[model samples]
Target: MNHTLTFNWMMGFVIAAMALGAGQAQAAYVIPMIGGAQLGPMDGTPMKHLDISFDGTNLSVHVDDMVPTPLLRPLESPDEFDPAEPWAVLTDKAYNYQYGWNPAGFITLPSNSAIWVQRLSQDSGLESYQRPPASPPYASIFASDGDIWQWSGSMTHNVYAVLNPTQSVYSASYRVYLGDSVTGVALDGYGSDDVTLLFNATVSAVPEPGTAMMLTLAGAAMLRRRRTA
Candidate 1:
């Protein structure tokens, strides 16, 4: 009888462990890039205004041109970039939430114009898990116009360990559309050379229920073992 009971209990524990591991929730939340403009120009030109958005996988750029000129284009099949690479950074602000921005870098425009960027993220209470890398730096893209833009170039941000609700932080990199409005920059107090890139991102994390259940089961097992001994 004792052996049978012990075997049943061990089996229960094994099942609980498997359930906890499998119950994790991996989710990613995306907020489109809206309202932005370039502040300065790299070639000494005035700033520009642009429109941008993300498809949770890639960036979609829309440029407001006087004619039918395509301002920017996204890289085709850009699912090759590593998420762990630090292409941007988030600043732990004086407030509760951190500031998110893109890393400073060059993206080839379809119009053959290389534009600098400062990608900005919407204010959300998302936590960071690791420090941003130094090589591929992130930058701060301020909000201007109805689209996000950069006057001079890409910006760099430093990542800090964030206490995310899901206890997970994941990032991926890809090339997307970047556009600018010829007239909106100056009106929005930005230069006309900035562009916004859309990205298709996917993030994952463990759910809370599974974690809590596992902890409870562990404690129970420990207590049982102590009583039996």
Candidate 2:
């Protein structure tokens, strides 16, 4: 083939490869909140305001500060409440007991998406009251706008309360799970006081192997054209 024809074919292949690569790459981003305002005077109020960006794909949040309040019925024997295995109310009304806005504040997740919370780390105290254990892991704790609180098996108990008067600091990392259909999440700190919270997220764009190979081939084509010229 003539040089002109060969060059044209190579250019076409490169453009096609780049388009294919771009299509295969999934975009990812991170949203972070640092040094947030404090919440509360122990008045059973929610505080701390923050915002989150959820655009369909997987995202994670790192929380530093604030505390979560687990709502359970008053137990006849408060001592019987185990911090390690705190119980949650089983009834659908239990949603009221779960408070998501305490530690990290209110979070709005994508509509119609099944949410998942994976605890990475935490430092706080659990205040337990006698209440029936909700379904395992308390998945139902978060119910759209009404209830957005989350709990971790690794944490102390059902209620993540601040007991010390000296302002003890708390920090935790969590992986938020949102189904494919959900997008655009919002979080706010409304009931917390005397504590500062911070959040950070890491996003990545993952490309398929085929896409990576095509990108490499496209680079080679450019180099060949340069040399021939």
- Candidate 2 Cα misplacement greater than 4 A, ranges: 1-45, 49-52, 58-113, 124-158, 162-167, 179-229
User: Model 1, 54-102: lDDT tens per residue?
Assistant: 3323444444343221111111221122345442132211101122333
Across 1-229, the per-residue lDDT of candidate 2 in tens digits comes to 3756655665687778667877763532211111111113244434332223334343433332263432222222112323334232221111122333222333464444444443444443322221223334433232222222332212212333223212223344444444333331323322111222322212224568755665576678788878999
Misplaced by over 4 Å in model 1 are 1-195, 203-205, 208-211, 219-229
Give the range of the ten consecutive residues with the poorest summed lDDT in model 2.
Answer: 30-39
Which candidate number maximizes TM-score?
A: 2
Q: What lDDT is reached at residue 52 by model 1?
A: 42
TM-score for each model: 0.25, 0.26
lDDT of each: 0.32, 0.34
lDDT of 2: 0.34
Give the CA lDDT, 0 to 100, for residue 21 in model 2.
71
True-structure lDDT of candidate 1: 0.32
